[model samples]
Target: MSNSLTVGVVQQPAWPDKARSLAASEAGIRAAVSQGAQLVLLQELHATHYFCQYEDPALFDLAEPLDGPTGQRLAELAKELNIVLVGSLFEKRAAGLYHNTAVVYDRAKGRVGQYRKMHIPDDPAFYEKFYFTPGDADDERGQGFTPIDTSVGRLGVLVCWDQWYPEAARLMALSGAELLLYPTAIGWDPNDDDAEKARQKDAWTIIQRSHGVANGLPVLVANRVGFEPDHSGVGGGIAFWGGSFVCGPQGEMLAHAGEETQQLVVNIDMARSENTRRIWPYLRDRRIDAYGDLTRRYRD
Candidate 1:
């Protein structure tokens, strides 16, 4: 059997309306499946606009059960396309309990698993704390760093703010993940200069790529694009820099996207990770016995 998988990332702007956004995403998923993608990824909160820009109790209405309309729609799509799909959603775990969750669906397995975003951001424009509670260490199924085993491969799925933490990536790698997938909703402030935006984008790209290099696994990020204003009319809003991308195990970028609407599909070798890990040996060289400080909040 060929040890390669063709993956696709959907990078599109979200609409205020849920139905419209789902329709657009369905079209994008079909586009990718048509082009021979076995596994597809969608941007974070793909069902609606990036609403974390402001604190609003009304926005909580956007949350839904995993098997809700959005989940059912995606499941139907994956079953129809006969492909593995990784997507994100605003999860309504229970009444008054919400989470930023990444859900994975397989063609044969229905709903494989989900990863609640461990790190929730609460910056100026990104008011996530007011909206989302921090993710538990384990999912409802009681698993952390558990890669979903599918027809495509083992996917180490994660979410936006979780992308910045290397520990999360490493744990996934240690759990036998072949690829790291991050459904992201990241952007820049409208007031920031062009230089700052560029720098932020570059940092976002590099740090994740370094995860691939450090763990000997491929990394994929699907980010939303376009400008979304604060619905409460409190902040200037965010311009989500849609630069979705994929990279190889050796930190070599296989595909990259610009700051616009795009549907990126890239083919990658799944077997290369084993070869690279054998040569680099970072996993073997880990001094697991000496690193006890990582569990602490800070060294100081």
Candidate 2:
């Protein structure tokens, strides 16, 4: 078998209406599949605006059951297109419990695995903590990082805030993930100056790229684009810097979408990761025995 995979990302602006948003994603996926993409990823919470800007309880209405309408529609699409699909959504685990979860569907297996976001941010105009409950029932907090096995590849999937943490990526790599995937909804504060905005966006991209380099695995990010006004009047709404991209194992960007609403399809050479790891061998030189302090909250 050829050790290569074609992946696609749908970087779309959110619509208030769920049906409309689904349709937009559908169109993007279809376009990418037409281009021979075997696996596709949609941005974080593609069915709605970055609603965490306002923390009203009313927004909980957006949360849906794991097998709800969104999953049903995605399953149909995956089977029809013969593609593996990964999508992030507001998961209504129960009446009083909720999570920001990423659901994965194999073309032949339907719903395979789901990763509940481990990190929840509570920044200005990004009140994610008010909404999301962290994953991983094993710990006091944090859903343990584990890669999902898929027909396309083993995916080390993480959500937006989780992408910033190197530990998360390392754990996924150590767990046998072939690639790292992040479903992100990141952007700049309109109040920040141009330089600050540029810095923030650059840092985000660099951090994700480092994961691919450090782990010797390909990386994919699907981010939302366009700006949405803050209805709650916290401050100027976020202008989502939609630089969705894919990178090779050596931290080289294979392809990227600009700061606009567009669907991206990129061909990835999986064989390159094995060759790069053979030469770099970072994992082989690991000092795994001496890293006891990594488990601590902080060393005093």
Candidate 3:
């Protein structure tokens, strides 16, 4: 594997229309490729507005098979651009079955692999548990921490909430992932206090950076920006704080987006991971034999 790779993260406001969203994403990918980005990542569920704000059976129509139109389009895009593309989608596996999945396409190898989000959060405005089935033993065979082999290297791709779990990062590293990529859609309740919002965003960034340092690999996060209305006509909606960023193996920020509006194309040296791991030796020093409690729900 080479030491360096140029990556691009798209941060833009989403609209309720799917057609417009696809067009915008396509344009963004083209622009990134033109700028020499070998790998491009998009926000979570980028094909439509954040739809989990409310639980309605009608919204289930939005889900489609992984090999459906959206996947086909992205596959074509990867081929046309000749670049690896990472995209997240609301997948329709079967009738009344769905999942929040991320697909990775290696331009050279074609549709390389995929990962279904393991953690399903069910917060007030975020009703994801209603739409997605938690990824378990069934999905892990074809979709798990197993990295996607690409011309660039093995890619450790995880969805939004999965970023908070150290186990997920560790598994990916053990599976030979050269870098960690997160496709996220996170923000604040519009009614949240300014101080709370600042704290929340900081905590989010810090946790992911910690993953980079702990696993001895670079971390790339792509998040959506702008505000989307609550379909339930709730008092307020989500204001996506677009602080997408790329961090080095040692948790140093290589590039960051602004809270309001920002898009970045950053170059990362994949070789730094080896050097950082040599110095920190977190992985080499881990006592895997003493972590039996991790399997139990609680140690009590």
Q: Work out the TM-score per prediction.
A: 0.97, 0.96, 0.96
Note each model's CA RMSD in angstroms. Answer: 1.3, 2.0, 1.4
Give the top-scoring candidate (TM-score): 1
Clashes of 2: 2
Off by over 4 Å in 1: 139-142
Give the per-residue lDDT of model 1 (tens digit) for 63-152: 999999899989988898899998888999999999988889999678888888888898988889988877778665735667777778
Clash count, candidate 3: 1
- Local lDDT at 234 for model 2: 68
For candidate 3, what is the lDDT? 0.87
CA lDDT, every model vs. true structure: 0.89, 0.90, 0.87
Expressed as tens digits, the lDDT of each residue in 162-246 for candidate 2 is 9999999999999899989999999988889999998999999999999999999999999998888898886798899999999
- Point out where model 2 deviates above 4 Å: 137-143
Specify the highest-lDDT model's number: 2
lDDT of model 1 at residue 120?
Answer: 87
**Which residues of candidate 3, in runs, are more than 4 Å off?**
138-141
| Pairwise TM-score winner, candidates 1 and 3 | 1
Q: Each model's number of backbone clashes?
A: 0, 2, 1
